[model samples]
Target: MTFSSSYLFSLTTFIYMGAAALYLIHWIFRVKKVGFLATVVTVGGIVIQTVGIGLRWIESYQLGYGHAPLSNLYESLVFFSWVTIVVYLIIEWQVKQRVIGAFATPFASLSMAYASFSPNIEDKIQPLIPALKSNWLIAHVVTCFLGYASFAVACGLGIMYLIKNRFSGASEGIMGVIPDCKILDELIHQTIVFGFLWLTLGIITGAIWANDAWGTYWSWDPKETWSLITWFVYATALHARFVRGWAGRRIAYISIIGFASVMFTYFGVNFLLSGLHSYGAQ
Candidate 1:
């Protein structure tokens, strides 16, 4: 890693950690000033991370790799963390809610932390392999991570929902800042819909990339199979909502379940099973 990118990324970790503290404190105490500071720091950290990613891309070129930073596990984790914040910031702006950050930003921080610290992971930026050297790499990885980020947000909100629901009627102080069940349900549904679409696009892009690399459109690789299973799980959730009017807690549970499938598709397949995309394994 270049000096600039490495330093910036390290700074991003602490900035997010502090932001998480500020956000959680604000949510608990309703401190306007602290929440404002949290917002500033979160946005600032995101900007810094963006610069870090850009620097990494430049560094890749300097090393003659000449590829986007989305070429490996470390880069993808960083990208995923970045996208999660981007998605959360947008939702916080649109809904004008800050408390969700209490549940959201820690995931971003931990993703960075893990990428930085995990002994099992490799952070070096090597040249793209033959299979990954295509326009489809960017499209496939970006779209998929967007979907993953959205689902991550949905998972966080699902936890918030259950908490808010558990003490909603009886204990106002514990879950006071949490929005009502209706709003939480709607937000979860909206995120799921957004994620499902992006996952669909990611799958399509992956198919295109696969055919380009391997001369086949749909081989049932383990990762591919798990992704398809995830797609079906969300599809079933959506269908239940549209046709059977499933909503509220059921939908929230489904969102959590779908994210489990997503995690498996992302980390589990790469770690436990060998496949065509074995390069992803640490």
Candidate 2:
């Protein structure tokens, strides 16, 4: 990548960190201006990140190899964080709530920062390996990360729900900044539903890709297994909420557990286990 492009990526990381801090402070102090500033900084970071991705693509072509940045763990993680922030911003705009952004922004920023700065992670735009040289690569990776991002948002809402539920009868000032427990629970459920739909599509597309590349629809790879485990957790949450008439604290706790599985699917599988998706490790 060009020096300028790397610089832009660095700047984007810093901006996101600032935005995340602003969001957290807003939640703690209930400052409207801090939330507004967080939104502004986040948008700025996204714009810079877009430019960085574009520059990396051009750099790949200049190196006589043309491929999307998604070919590597670092690039994929950066893109994952970018998509997470974008989706969180959209949800915040629609819901007119900033509390979730408090948690989401920090996590997103930290992930991006890790990708950008970690020496163990490779940031070069290398040619795609033969195993990954397929059209389905983009679809599979993008869809899965989108689902992961949505779940990350849901996880943030779930955390908020727990906090609000715990302080429902308390007179804490910070607790007052959170929404009602019922509203928090509803928001968590809605975000999880959104995540579940995307995750289903991601897994289906990945299955098709595996079939095309390896002539098998399922191999129970570590990544695939963890993803299935995550799906089951969320599915159980849905069943509990709808069939068992569970809501509020129980549902919030389930979402927390489900999102923990989501984290394992995204990070734990790569770092702690062996798999075909080891390219996702960083």
Name the candidate that leads on TM-score: 1
Tell me each candidate's TM-score.
0.96, 0.95
Off by over 4 Å in 1: 243-245
- lDDT, candidates in the order shown: 0.90, 0.84
Tell how far residue 153 is off in model 1, in angstroms. Answer: 0.4
Expressed as tens digits, the lDDT of each residue in 137-156 for candidate 1 is: 99999999999999999989
- Candidate 2 lands at a TM-score of 0.95
Residues 90-133, candidate 2: write the lDDT tens digits: 98899888877887887788888888888998887778878888
lDDT of 1: 0.90
Model 1 clash pairs?
none
